[model samples]
Target: MPLPTGPVIGIMMDNLKKRKSVFPISGRKAVKWSQKLEIPVGGETVLYTGSMYQLLPYMIAAVNRMGKMEDSFLGQYVGLGRFFNKMFNVSSIMFRPKRADHKRFRRIIRDIARLLQQAGVDFGYLYKKELYAGALAFDLGVDETFVAHAQRLSNLFKAQGVRSLITIDPHTTNVLRSVYPTIIDGFDIEVKSYLEVLAENDTLRPINKVEGEITIHDSCVYARYEDVVEQPRQLLRRAGYTVKEPKNNRNLTHCCGGPIESLFPSMAHQIGGKRVQQLKDAQGKGVATMCPICMATLQQAANGDLEIDDIASFLAKAFCPPGANDKSAEEKRSQP
Candidate 1:
């Protein structure tokens, strides 16, 4: 079904008007925690927050809007005119939006940090300084807002002396690595996905091990656009899972139906369901996703029939080991 055009545009405009994001709460909390710990933020290496943590909220709001619309006059009128080309597009059942699994996003952030620590790649997170990368704005064809956001983000990074950025997700990575350069003159900043950065340091070893056959879902933007197909797989293999390839893998990978989710949820679901079935056809023990949007979209489409995990989470579990926790050895050992 075509997405509810009116509502999607409204949400985008709302996001622009807010000048932040509809889902800044989580990242704001993370920033607060970093401040409490006196963690020095913003230097040569900055941890890019982007919209990975906020993706769930966008999905939640969109799904919620669809729900509220179902019982309104629009739904009744749309049904009455069933003969129209847009008929049968009145239901939000396609997206059984869960409680917006934010805990998972937090875990993904921590996992990235731990992985970086193991790789001996020191970085600082901006926390409060981090801004949404405006990937959604770019994707929705809202160029004016996106360019303005990009300029502001560039200025923020430049002021912070951030020479390099470790992006958390493909969308951010693509926006920073590919899109920004085209629009923002002198966009001299270096952007690397956490996967690319981690992959560069071969000495990084997993302190723990996990056993499973994981089927990988490649992010369309990462794979096709940024050529980030190998870094994730390399990390997963290093984590000790037997990597299984679905028929549509690598550059030929199928989308999890996320890119257009905001504008076309029902069609997104149909596409997502088909991709889920494709992953199931591989019959791997679980499905591993490298993008937050992919994880959220597929998890919903799977409806608990399949286990989905962010690749970073799986790698963190493999490398960090149980009992290691997230603590400095000095602090842990000094505690009675």
Candidate 2:
């Protein structure tokens, strides 16, 4: 039997519709990673996280619980959970992500910020004002909800005086750049992925040369939708890491099975496993993923067989100065 997708999607959509996030994470929690960096609140060209990385750990935890129930006798009871979710936030009670997982994802976001700073990019964060880009709702075809959310986000950006956006993840970059303008009138915000920003800055050279070949997992949204295929590669090459291409790469990049994980956990796992194997076939020292979903999904599938990390983690190690990894040290260094 197929998983009960209707109730599952309903739970997620309800969370997004009510909480402004696909998962019910507080805005404070969403922006916690940037606190230590002392990024100013809002600017013309802001670093818009879209809360993708912050929400992934919770999303993954929820999917893991759901996967156990999928296609089994327990799966039928998910509708009951949806019923309670409407009354209260059931996801908060049902899915508690591991502390270590939360820390890892938080570090990835910090690394991204560090990379941007090292590149001499002057950007501010929206902090608690930051909102999820409604990628899941947009992807799942909840048109009404997505449209409303998009309008709200557009209003937030305009009110904050945001002109251009430096997005961290592929989904946010694609939706904010390509989809938002199509749906919302007068949506003129310029969106570019941080990779593109870093790649274009010639002054941001790697201080420590990293010697190893890493396979690149191109995000479908970034590759086909946003033409972000070359930016990450250029940055990686400049960071002194030899880029390896997976069999299905660039425009033909394979899905990490993450987009559908909320609905079909087992199937998504199978797809992730296949993609991991494809990366292994590339025979690189490790795998680098530009998408948060890709990193989470592929890491789960790899199961310690392969080393999988976000592309920013690699760049941060090479480009960021010593003590950049320590929050206190970085805070002191950024103090001017």
Best by lDDT: 2
Clash count, one per candidate: 0, 0
Each prediction's TM-score against the native? 0.84, 0.95
lDDT of 2 by residue, 244-315 (tens): 999999999999999888888889999999999999999999899999999889988988788888899888
**What CA RMSD would you report for each candidate?**
7.9, 4.4
Candidate 1 lDDT, 38-128, residue by residue in tens:
3456779887867566456446555556545555555434333323313222222233333324444555677777778778787887777
Runs in model 1 lying further than 4 Å from the true structure:
1-7, 22-27, 30-39, 67-100, 323-336
Query: Over 4 Å off in model 2, which ranges?
Result: 326-336
TM-score between model 1 and native: 0.84
Which pairs of residues collide in candidate 1? none
Q: Please report how far candidate 1 places residue 44 from its true position, in Å.
A: 0.9
Model 1's lDDT to the true fold?
Answer: 0.73
